[model samples]
Target: MARHSFQSAMATQAGNGHVLGYTVWNHFFRPETDELHPMGITQLNRLVRRSWREPLQLYVETAHDLRFDPGAPADYAKDRDELDARRMQAISTYLSVVANRNDVNLFVHDPPRAGMSSDEAWRGDKDMVHGAPRGYLTAEAIAKGAISSEAPGGFPITLQPDLGGAGMAFPQPPNFGGDIPVGDFGGDFGGEFDVPPGF
Candidate 1:
């Protein structure tokens, strides 16, 4: 679905036992729409049929640029960090829905411990991507995820072959940028699923 579609899902699910909204760093491999990433809520809502409430989850990317506010024409909620705790509070909302303990994933790529190489990465250390400032899904927050993993320091990233998990599974945590293949540039990517009864 698109931005409108996503918001419709959230607003409908809001206060209904599902999640209200999610905190974010405003970055990701957003499927290009008009040569740009579509709306987050819209994207999430579109995948409602494949959603799993038992572990109904969403990813929150963070980086330094997450400190800024989003522009107008908001499809759903606003991406603004007018205050400090509110930022964290936004994330807290996601936790509330899942009823989990701060299940936040910090997708960052700093020098010492960065998960991104393209300075213009959506969640890079401090770069502008698609007219939006880089976000902060801090490494410190990964542990908060339902299942957090990391590629230790200095492990060159490599997009060996995760072909949507056809038959290959990563042995270790995923580093930001290895000499791998696929993805925006070239890194380990893709998450697959089993085919249903019939395609």
Candidate 2:
């Protein structure tokens, strides 16, 4: 269900012709299967291929150690770290092979223990993940850096065309001819515009 929902939204986003780019945190792992879910690797592939010629920028983030399952106890810290490592490896592989392009940017963040001599580095507000306020600030810094620097081969970051002088030029819908099919999309999800969890 999750995979299908993701696919439908991705198709809509690419076809909408206004969205240029977005960021994704590496937290789509399924503990039971111990693999990065198809949301990023598979569904994203579909979008990238469909819009291969479009100017779409994707920023893939490394696993942030601060986020965790709130129910898990502190004793699971080591296990979570190991999982993050594995998730990073999988993300790296996908970036190198599938999403390797000037449009796709990968940012590597420092681990929670990078500059800390003790657990104080992870300290933050109660009921929050590690590094609470400060750790998130570090993430924001990295993201800003990635966006500020020029991408290899230098693709200009244009969210939308100029609208002040003339009316905004929305992309024309693809001419799919008159053919239409009635059936499942060969996936669980059916609609193309169902909103995902977060906007």
Candidate 3:
């Protein structure tokens, strides 16, 4: 079932004009299987020691032989928090939804923030923090989607796109066909242009 779901997700993404290049989001983190599970470092230790080796090896080197993008996390961290959030969401979704796994254990295996004492072995594990980049969806795009300062009172919060990609030119109805003009939106077409010059 897991394999089928993964295949289906790939198919769906491909059907939507996306090229599936395994990169940063190639790995999946098998979160706690049991319900009402206890949380601890021990579980992480076990997962790192056991489940990760083969899966990661296959991801890093396959027929395609895709590799994780090694960039400065500081580069992404400097961007607006929203951008960071979107990146996290996309990566997480890719692993959990697309890869059919819960808990981003693979990505979360950060040794930098692990707070271990400064040592050669610990420093070597810094690569864990430098997560790989999934080709199409970068950290920037993901961060944008994560935030929603949704306007209160059931109002749609306009998407104020940040410094990077093009902000939406302007929102319109989903169908967006016909002569949907501004203000009246052509809804009341041929109607008198009222308002008395900004009364």
Tell me, by TM-score, which candidate is best: 2
Tens-digit lDDT string for candidate 3 (21-60): 2222212222211111133223333443544434431111
Please give, for residues 35-148, the per-residue lDDT of candidate 2 as tens digits. 667676674576567668855454434444445667876736666566556665665667557677455533434322223444554453322321111111134344455333
The number of residue pairs in model 2 that clash at the backbone is 0
Per lDDT, what order, best first? 2, 1, 3
Query: How high is the CA lDDT of each candidate model?
Result: 0.35, 0.44, 0.34
Which stretches of model 1 miss by more than 4 angstroms? Answer: 1-25, 28-38, 66-88, 91-199
Global CA lDDT of candidate 1, please?
0.35
Alpha-carbon lDDT of model 3: 0.34
TM-scores for all candidates: the values are 0.21, 0.27, 0.18
lDDT (10s digit) by residue, model 1, range 1-199: 6999999988776743333233233442232111113454354434333443444454343333333334543421233222223434444453456434343432222222233466556455332211221122333343355222322332222223323322221222332465543243344433322233212
Task: Note the residue pairs that clash in candidate 3.
Answer: 24-132, 24-133, 82-143, 83-143, 86-142, 86-143, 87-142, 87-143, 181-185
Better of 2 and 3 by lDDT: 2
Off-target runs (Cα >4 Å) in candidate 2 are 1-27, 32-34, 46-72, 100-199
TM-score, candidate 2, is 0.27
